[model samples]
Target chain A: MSSTLTVADVERIAALAQLELTAEEKQLFTKQLADILDYAEQLQAVDTSGVPATAHVLGEPVERDDAERPSLAIDEAVGNAPDPASAPGLFRVPRVIG
Target chain B: MLQSTASAIREDVASGRVSAVEVCRAFLDRTTAVNAALNAFNLVTSERALAQAAEIDRRRAAGQTLGVLAGVPVAIKDNLCVRGMTTTASSRILEHFVPPYDATVVARLAAADAVVIGKTNCDEFAMGSSNENSAFGPVRNPWAQDRTPGGSSGGSAAAVAARCAPLALGSDTGGSIRQPAGFCGVVGLKPTYGRVSRYGLLAFASSLDQIGPFTHTVRDAALALSAIAGADPSDATASREAVPDFAASLTGDIKGLRIGVPRAFVADGVDAGVRAAFDAAIGTLRGSGAQLVDIELPHARYAIPVYYLVATAEASSNLARYDGVRYGYRSARDKDQNLKQMYSRTRDEGFGAEVKRRIMLGTYVLSAGYYDAYYLKAQQVRTLVRQDYQQAFEKVDVIAMPTSPIPPFRLGERTGDPLQMYLADVFTVSANLAGLPAISVPCGFSEGHLPVGLQLTGRMFDEATLLRAADAYERETDWHAQAPAI
Candidate 1:
């Protein structure tokens, strides 16, 4: 009994994602998007009782030693940059804010 | 020679019958030939492969002891960072990004002397059941050109299926590895969460994502698992237990083993052909002296919802690093704008459509007003889903089901129906929910010549039993030997 996703929903999602979609893509994604949502919504009916909610299945937190190990050289890390200009240490991005 | 398993390759390398360079070149040549059509690889590390292969040859000449997997060629899913290699996760955002360090799995594989062939394609950020979500493009199923290779490990599965690589590494969260393996008719395993470290893997759903192996045969998959799975200082969550030699369990005997069939979960919406093949596989196991039991996992019905909510919420948080401030695509025209525009334009131009959709949906579910209604409820339901499996495990040694509801569908068949694509993961997602180890092995073929996978889900940390059952089944069946007619 799930309904299809509307074009408006797709547009809203695109806006949230900051993606600019073409008209054709929007049309195609409407049906596709609806189907995905409907399928995901199928989990709405299960009953969970007396069970502890798990955040990490392995039941352990990700931890690494705080010790500093030899790391990649800064030059080597950014050496492959497509374009390097004023920024000598990192990959440079165009200035967006005035 | 191309059809030889990783074990054989190791033996050949040790014996000097084949040098690592020869093996690497053969695989590279084959990959190059099929890659154009299959799109299985995102990057080809021919130079790297040759260099590693030569190093192995030098070690052999110097009479140095070789690692168990010496000179074996393996492909890594792009999501797992390999230092100096572009680990794009099949997203345009990181299209040119190279990792500064190798993931734990990659380092392990290299330690075993396995030559890293290249990076394979995946669904963007390991989201979506179909590889179509990859900004690079969908990987074509090697079985049928027009059909999709299941994802987000679609390329890893396809690479093995097409014989491009004998073994490949993939990450499974909500069936990414198993589902794609099912579609491509290869062997894929998702070990118990924490069995493998997640140190270098680009986080999808951290709780669910586990790096696993895809191979032509179950034992090879087991070998890869043994090599890569263990405690790591880099991943605090990694299990502290000593890594077991999974290859030692591949005796191909499951006598007196109990295998459960969840009639309630697997029977619904299963394609007739898939069901027939799965049943026949059960019959084969029964004939091999294993006991088959009917078990019910009532909470499985909620897995999809719980998985989506949790996975998306985590994805929303993990992917927030791509704000055009760090590594990833940035907007060229948005320079000198406000911080908000920088983030908005950068993400807009960087991420693929599917990724954006998930982020929005995830953010909505985790929003202040909707958290309890969506995210919190999903977590509660996840507990129920986990309990269902726990209860089922109390009654059986392992659970058996169809790896996928159906065989590979036509490439574009469900491209327009995201719901249908998501449903394709229904059979494989439960194990991820329970943090269980599971594997997909080729069982039989449909009339159309496409392969069907028989899935075996084991109890938490009971990968030995799962591999035993799968190896036993594989010994009795020829499904794993049947490759695509490429």
Candidate 2:
């Protein structure tokens, strides 16, 4: 829990998060993240032998009827697409299957 | 009209003393006049607001009954979408993205006849403790331009404090609303989790996120909450619990009410002026027939640590949709680049430094080997934090403390260090972790005339008691009546 964060660790996390970081950003994050994690290391001392984790304060997962209902219109849903004009009623993204 | 409460404005508009359009114009004019100095609003929807106001006026002329919040102007934090309005979460990624639907809360406000005047600026994706992280620029404190109106709901708080609007909406995730409300000298309330729907609010940390209000008075905060609380079909997590008439609950009577005080926890690391004001507020409460009982929240000291881990993890997952595939900013394509490269490039270009840092931290904490160490441990500790509150509430109806440990800091003072900025939310994060209702009211001012806030955390789904206690305090003092010179 007191592990030291390194530049390589940050690079790995950045890749996992799909974010491209500059050399300066990587260096800065390495120091800052290490300090923050160091501060968070205090949590490791709290003994939890049989305590259950709390994901949410809600009592139970709520369910709704699985039936047809009004939903977002295709044009309205795609209104904010980066390239909405490229294809009618669809969001155009860079070719992925190629 | 600018200085009037939402209740007063509604009465005036309803009785034909003033048209709803006039009330809208009064707030819009005040927003335009002060926004240049405060940078409170990112986009002022003059056309939409005027249209809404005109509809309210027409209904009045047609002999129809007005809603609870009839003709009151309200500013919204930019993260909550408004149909056809560009809802930027104070980030470049969504800078030009216009939603095709209104947030449930927004629709509810409209149903209550409250005019939405504008979208206020905030921390990008509501991440920073200071509003300086906004792509639109920082919102200055109305009391002092050099200091921050504590963020990420800083703009909404500043707007209400500056009298740009009688009421405003803000989202609280780790003190975004209450901290700023304290800094701006206004009444800010974060209802219990699921009390308000999160259907259209740009998700930050799903479990911790809750939408609330910033108003000039506790009664007005109660009014705004009544307009927006309850179950929503669009949001599954919305509580099925009954929505009480929050404004009607404010009888300004807290006789023999049990108040919990965690004196040891708040004794250290507090500014002298802020501590003094807090003590004075406690004394006032005691003098007003409220009984104070000492309580201990030992696990609360770790709230900041648990919050950062829990919130960032959820944010990383929630923000993963911004891959430039469907909406928002997309990076320029290169003939040789692959789809994966486009995602990294777009995210790198679109997100701010704080957002990226949190994303990276979240990814790290949830990664393979570190999951149990950071993320799981945080969840376990979160249970402790919640249990601490449950036990405390068994003995006392509400727990009281200073909303913020110190007076407002300068805009650029804590921006350089993210940890330092996070430490500022020390006193306000536990309520969110515990999923309880909390309110921040103007307690007193510092030697420099900067405002201080006294926070009250109440039982789950018990905002009625919270508002009652705060309203009672307001009747005993005139702190909420003191506005900034601006």
Candidate 3:
């Protein structure tokens, strides 16, 4: 029941992931990813009919008192920013809109 | 002194048998001597390590009692941030990005007076089973330089096996800690999920990722775990449960302990040598008062596929933050490109082949058409896997299994095949998926002289029993005593 992934599928997947793959990557991934996915099709054979999905094993959210605490200083938070230090103390990015 | 365990190192340092600085220097010298062959450490923080050691010595001179891990040399996996150190996750993306803070575990180790020697290598973003996926380089197995030390914690395990560091920190998302330890013939333990804080561990899979220790002995693992395992105000996921004295449980008496041996773990495709070693280890457990109980983990067979779906999905989202703007590697190709092109180019250039595969697969599974069919189904199967553990634990105190179905393979054997590499983790991922504490301790050696490890997984938050059982086996067997002639 498992067919190979097409070149078009790799392109669409790469685009969705915001990745720019070379032509070699496209061809290689189409086969490799398809093989992995086909192998993963083994899970479908098992009946998980009414099993509840486990988003987290603990399932219960940890409750903590919401209290004010010290946080990372602004400079520390943006210390590794690629942009130059700015007066607004924020990392500058490419202009979003004209 | 070269083969000293972490616990012994701490005691010797505190008792004035050796100065902390000298202890650190000895390991640092050993690291410099052998790291070229092992390639275990990505960056040896010699200056920082000496500084920390000097402080410990000063305190000891002032007659102040030391912490348990005081003066023990530790190598942290590159994934954990140490303030101002280039805490690259062995990926090109963060090759130069330094965090401004220490991880919760790092801070704890510092407070405990442990000396951190350096950062060890790992798979790019902790994505692969073999160390070959590392952007820096594969950590050659100390046992056989031609073979890969199992990974993505290969560097940590290799450093310990090579005696570059007596204790090292590794993060386990899907057996990154245990598999490599299994391959390297050392002790590694992944605490129950939320047992240890995850604040500074570069996220591979948030829910599944756990910081653990690689040590020469089970008692050393217990000591290291004690130093780092506790609740942190910064990490809400860390459990507030009072940590038991893990070392105290190593009484070498596990009389009447029930250890479940899951047939699924020893099923077909496991190497003959590994299976033989596993059966012999089970026999040793029987000799040491641990009762063998046959058990069924019906849905555990789906662990590999489920882990890939869940961990990659988490990776896809967690790694999306590394765009061109704020931090991490932004490609020079982004110079004149638009915002969209900048993001694509930076990621495309930053991530290695395996990391890109996971990201793309993660993005695909989480996309509109496949989310329900793949990701959701995997999560549902994850529930079944957890249930299987829950039911099995009802009848046994711990589950004993082979750590890896195969021994260490040649460095490039599985590089071209992702599925085969993923299967290397088949026996180890179920513990991660179920959020249980598991330890891999040297059990026996294969015919090739490569090491094999026995895995013992305990109930949630029951690390004491797991460590005690492992220590009992270590006491009864000389496997842990044998080190590879590096």
Query: Once model 2 is optimally superposed onto the true structure by TM-score, how far is the C-alpha of residue B223 displaced, in angstroms?
Result: 1.3
Tens-digit lDDT track of model 1 for B1-486:
799999999999999999999999999999999999999999999997999999999999999989989999999999999998998999888998988889999999999999999999999999978798999999999999888888899999999999988999999999999988988999999999889999999998888889999998888988999999898987887998677899998787888898888887886888888999999999999999999999988878777777777888888888888876557776666446666676677787788877876776676567666676667778888877787788888888989999988888887787655556776788888788788999999988876877889999998888988999999999998989998988
Ranking by lDDT: 2, 3, 1
Give me the runs in candidate 1 sitting further than 4 Å from their true place: A1-45, A49-51, A62-65, A76-87, A90-98
* Residue pairs of candidate 3 with colliding backbone atoms: none
| DockQ of candidate 1 against the true complex | 0.41
Give model 3's TM-score versus the native structure: 0.98
CA lDDT of each prediction against the hidden true structure: 0.85, 0.93, 0.90
Find the 10 residues in a row with the least total lDDT in model 3 chain A: A80-89
Name the best candidate (by lDDT): 2
Quote the TM-score that chain A achieves in each candidate.
0.72, 0.89, 0.84
Q: What TM-score do all the candidates reach, one by one?
A: 0.93, 0.99, 0.98
True interface contacts retained by model 3? 0.65
Two-way lDDT contest, 2 vs 3, winner: 2
